[model samples]
Target chain A: MREILRLIVVLSLICGISAGALTVARLNLASRIEKQSDFYVRGPALERLFGKPAEELLGNKISLPIGDHLYPIFYLTEGSEITELAVEAPGPGGYGGDIIVMIGLDLRENRMVGMEIIQHSETPGVGSRVEKASFRKQWQGLPVDEPVELTSQGGQIDAISGATYSSKAVVNGTNHIIDLIRRHRDDIMAVIKAKGE
Target chain B: MTLKQALVHGLWEDLPPFRLVLGLCPALAVTSSAENGLGMGLAATFVLVFSNMFISVLRKVIPDKVRIGSFIVVIATLVVLVEMIMKAYFFPLSQQLGIFIPLIVVNCIILGRAEAFASRNPVLLSMADGLSVGIGFTISLAVLGSIREILGAGTWFGWQVFGASFEPFEFMVKAPGAFICLGIILGLMNAYSRMRGETFIQT
Candidate 1:
């Protein structure tokens, strides 16, 4: 009986120490880790879309109120002036869950620069094929005003051969972005203006 | 066993999945790609080394009846620590590894080592055991991963090893493929050991 008490005390002490140490490490490294993930994973994708270093894009980042949330917004600059907008438009529910994406738009609002899948839980081979350049290429230079949908549904985009649901999720996300852009156009412009001052 | 023997046994004789036939779950689950296999192996190695070291250090105080529970707590703590560190620093690899990192807590190699070696040995020897076993596991996973990735995806480490004309045998990356590949590897190892006139396990 005494042995059990001793064992419990010792084990509790060990657990307490381990948890305490982990708490300290978490507190110390949480922010730095977030920054690293943003730089490593999201950095390359954003760079590919904007043709600018991720660091440069990060400098102009500001979160703007859209609907109920403050969505991340980046003002892409040509030289000294903000010429385009890169908004993080997390789309509605996907085949797996919410498909988060970044959509870049030219200042003239004529064409979408590009779009990149930021985070997704789609299946590896079938649904995950949506991340391939072939599927995403169809979105580049596409007019924002044009309704985005799979070709089978009377739209320009081609749904991935075996991953129609996943493809539709991306298209749905694109439409969500379009809606956000249309509704928040004036507010986005004002946010840009405020940043310039 | 000598220090060198302790350090080297896991490389082949006591090697996991093939010889000891332990921790086969992750071996089959994550070996679809060379990258994932290596990631899972290294993560296991990290957990194994720390748990072995800590367990050895605390062996004297831990009661025999509650030792398994104690070992589990220590192992779980280390696993969580590894998960947090991996998520913070190596976020992409961490995501790729996903649940396997946490699953290291139950890896038979780790618990088996603590019960068999770490509890009886000094810290240095336990550390050596951990490193050797880890390297052995990593090597095994890497070979398995290479086989699967090459045949399944027609690629090596995501690079195209086979020409575009080559049709990949996609079955090599699926669940059945994992079973088939591990079975073949185990068979080959047994055959090779028999030919060498050496017992697969010392016992």
Candidate 2:
């Protein structure tokens, strides 16, 4: 029918025009948005975990190949010398959904400088307690080579009250990423060294 | 409708999520904090105003049978554009808002106005309707968000209002909390309307 044809043409034109406009907008703003998200959303967590300000650390960010994805690895320097490495690891095996954690490593001290929950979908009151300082602070200065586990499973970490599953997810996720880092420790160090030049 | 009538209607008489009883999903989901509410509201307002205006301008050209489809495409495009821009420019706010930004396409308030108001109304009146409805939605979300944040977390806009000793009622920030808070507010609004003897949803 003529009516059907007209309807199709009108809808197609509207959709085509919209898609075209969006593509233009995206092309112009993609880089700025990526920079902003890093500075705003992930910046606070990184700043808290690292003693230095986020803006100072921004210059040292480098992407390292880890598994199938390019993971962002930030170098914490002291007067041109790379003193520490902060790796943004995927801890996707969360109770609710994927959990991303930012972990700092002190290469000289050979310990975990700190860890922060960058993004998570855990239950607000229960599982979401992972955002608390008390819970996350336990990882500071922890020996990176040793297995990270909850006290219930014969490990050192204490689980949040009434949130054992979510707590376990964080512990397991950290351990999983830690194991990968340990396996590829030399390559990680090499990448950091190359970026420092 | 007159510009004055259109603007006034969105503010009180046909306030979305309350009097209009529309767009309750975002109202409940994002009102856990004042910041989230404000962010969602402003974003929605941007989409509503632009979408309404676009719909109004193209109303005559759009065939009646496929008007819904055209309206949806326009809205969907705007939502995508907003989502990309937010992710690129306002990363923190975008992250805080999460999936709610993309979900705006389905929000009844935007599409509702496009169909009921923009499709039939003149351009200026449609624009006025868009602005007023948006302001109404924003105010309602803000009130809900502030109350929830204050009671649930003892904070407003992430700043501590209560002293260190004050214990927060954790229940007020959860899903049940959203329902309870919105329900009470809706009841109060209904009571206020009863007192004024003004019927809501007057066409």
Candidate 3:
């Protein structure tokens, strides 16, 4: 009976202490982890979209709260004029996991400038073929308000053979970015305007 | 045991995966590149040292019946802590090591020391043992990683070690290569020990 009591006491104490330490560490490092993950995971994709490395592009990042989540938007400027904006978001309904994509919007031209696949866990050689430059070429200079869907549905995107779900993920991801832009236009302009001041 | 003896014991006598024949999962899984292997080693080393020290301090208070449970709590917490730190500061290396960092919680070496050595030892001595064993593991992993990286990828720590024309042995960086390389190294070490008239692999 004493042994059982002691075991309970010791194990509880150990677990309690451990939980405290872990909580502290997690709280302290949470933001930095988020930043680092973004810098590494989405950095390359942003670089590809913006025609500059993420190190430079992220320097002018402007964030706005869209619904419950704060969306970080990176912008490129030509001297004082903001030339374009880049944003990455996870598109739902992917075959495997959330298909993350970074897209650039040309502020002056009102067109979709460029796009790069930020992350995905889709099946290789088939579903993963969405990453190919040939397929990705479809997005360059597309009008920002273009309805992004597959060709069979009367949209421009042609689903890669044996990869409808993954291709749909990219299409959905692009539309998601467009919706974010349309919804947050006022908030985005306010932030950019505030920065200009 | 003296601090020096505790430290030295892990370097050669209980060297992991080689001498102790333990921690082969990470040894095999994350050793595709030198940087990856080194990152994993350092992460495990961090867990091992801290967990050993904490367990040693609490040795008497932890009842024997639930000691394993206590050890696990400490080990798992430290693993999570290390994972957070890695994600924050060593983000690239952390990404490369990936799931292996969290999996350090189940690594036998940390628990092995807690059960076999730290449980009976003084706190300082236990810490010394932890550092020594961790360093040995780091060295073993780094060496294995180097051999595989150089031959398999024709690079060492991502630096080209061969002329451009030199074709890399694609097989050397694959899963089967880890097994073959580990086997050959183990055999060679055993041969060396036999030649020196010493004991066979001792845990």
Fraction of true contacts retained by every candidate, in order, equals: 0.49, 0.83, 0.98
Per-residue lDDT for B1-203 in model 1, tens only? 78899899999899987888899989999999999999889988988888999999999998887899889989998888888888787888887876677788999989999999999999999999999999899999999999999999999999999889999999998999999999999888888888888965433
lDDT of model 1 at position B37: 92
TM-score of chain A of each: 0.79, 0.79, 0.80
The numbered model that scores best in DockQ is 3
DockQ values for all predictions? 0.35, 0.51, 0.64
lDDT score at residue B90, model 1, on the 0-100 scale: 81
Give TM-scores for every candidate, taking all chains together and pairing residue i with residue i.
Answer: 0.70, 0.74, 0.82
Second chain of candidate 3: TM-score? 0.97
Model 3 has a DockQ score of 0.64
Q: Which window of 10 residues has the lowest lDDT sum in candidate 1 chain A? A: A74-83
True A-B contacts kept by model 1: 0.49
What TM-score does chain A of model 2 get? 0.79
Worst 10 residues of 3 chain B by lDDT: B194-203
lDDT of 3 by residue, A70-131 (tens): 67788777877777888777777677787888788998998987778877767655777888
Q: Model 3: residues >4 Å from true position, as ranges?
A: A1-12, A30-42, A53-55, A77-83, A92-100, A107-111, A117-176
Docking class of 1: acceptable
TM-score (0 to 1) for chain B of model 1: 0.97
Residue-level lDDT tens digits of model 2 in A1-197: 98889888888888888889988998998788768868875677678878678888877788877668877777777776667877776675577876777788887888998888877777766888998999999999899888788898899899998888778777876876688678887787687778667
What do the candidate models score in CA lDDT, each in turn? Answer: 0.85, 0.85, 0.85
